[model samples]
Target: FVFADVIGQIVELTPIEVVSANGKETHKLTVELRNEKDERLPMVLWGNFATDVSDAIQGRGENAIICVLRFGKIKVWKYERSVLNAYNVSDVELNPLTPEVEAFASLLSSVYIVMCTIAAIESDMGCYYLSCKVCSKKVLNVPNDNIDEQGDEDEMGFHYYCVKCKVKNPRLMPRYKLHLVVLDNPGNSKFLLFDAIAMQILNRPCNELTGSNFEEMQDPEDILLALKDLV
Candidate 1:
């Protein structure tokens, strides 16, 4: 799709994450932009754009302002449409005093960002889940599947299937999904930290703590130790 501008309130902001794409490590952050009409669209900010937005949210502690994206491109994955910034060509602005923002200023309200402390590990629910390396979606093993030409089954069980991507023997990765109780000003509340936030808090990715083999469950000792250290 053609590059265009998108302005909305930033909501559901994820921590800045470093991921490997095309053999290069890059920073990325995912966020939802909510318009005045309450329509929300998912958008991903990569490289400097990711760090810039994360820094703004950290410094402001509120997400109620308008975000301006210039030259952002639309991306579709599995029939879901989202926005992504065009490399080197896109620009990002948080709370710019533009005419467009001033026109819709009255319709927007600041959303408070909450700060919580980790109280304790809620359960032994494990630390991560197996997901497709391509799309980061959960995948299932295909039974009686033929081995790839590389004969991966002997090394690591092969033939996992992604229902969404519709691929066989797809590469896999481990993603964090921790169950914990967090304490904030109000009270203790249960919080489930998925891969993005969990990696940010843990200072490491799930792959660092576990293996990619779906049939073999990795020892959660490292993950548990990290969680205990946080408490």
Candidate 2:
């Protein structure tokens, strides 16, 4: 088996197209690869290897580590072998735990805890806001509308407001785009953002905070510090 280290975010997935040539059907897959150094290479998955393309692309987001088997034939155009075959994509790992990964994970975990604590406090105060630490924006909730862009009825929908940015933003932002900033007890700081549902879950209204006026709200930092001590 031809083995090579390949890592990249899945940029595109071509629809499976079959062509008949010389009384035989041929299947091919075109995949784009970008390495850590940001080099781009086009790989072709052919025949039996092409069958595994769907599973390999499933849930594999951008900037993921992927291993590929490379096979190709010499071509004059590039003064190198033209990639003719590829596949057996396995050992797929996301955001590999390198030094950078470890640092990021620690920062994210810390930020997540802080945000959760804030949300818990706010939930007690009967207020909900999606906080973006990177932009320092607070997302506000809007009444659910039963219509979509096409004027079609969209009963299962809601909207949000960003008080800081002064723009209507999507309720669901991509995970990669959101990050957390962490402030450790030792004065170290970092940033992080949770997926939408996680954010809501962390802030789910509780009896202590729910139905309470904002003026009666307590400091989130105090709650966070207490929770931290417990941990």
Across 1-231, the per-residue lDDT of candidate 1 in tens digits comes to 768899888766654556778899777889988888878889899888887787677567533657899999988789887899988999999889888988776786545466998887754566677778886666665444444445655345445666546788678887877778889987887766778778888898878766444443345444446667888
lDDT of 2 by residue, 1-231 (tens): 334544343333343334454688655656655544445566556665554564445445333434343334323355533344433443333456566545434433121124322212222332233433344333444555545454222343545544434566533221211122334555533223333333354453322333232222235433322223212
Q: Assess every candidate by TM-score.
A: 0.50, 0.31
TM-score, cand. 2 vs. native: 0.31
Over 4 Å off in model 2, which ranges?
A: 1-10, 59-65, 70-81, 86-231
Error of 2 at 71 (Å): 4.6
Clashes in model 1: which pairs?
A: 64-110
RMSD to truth, every model = 10.9, 16.6
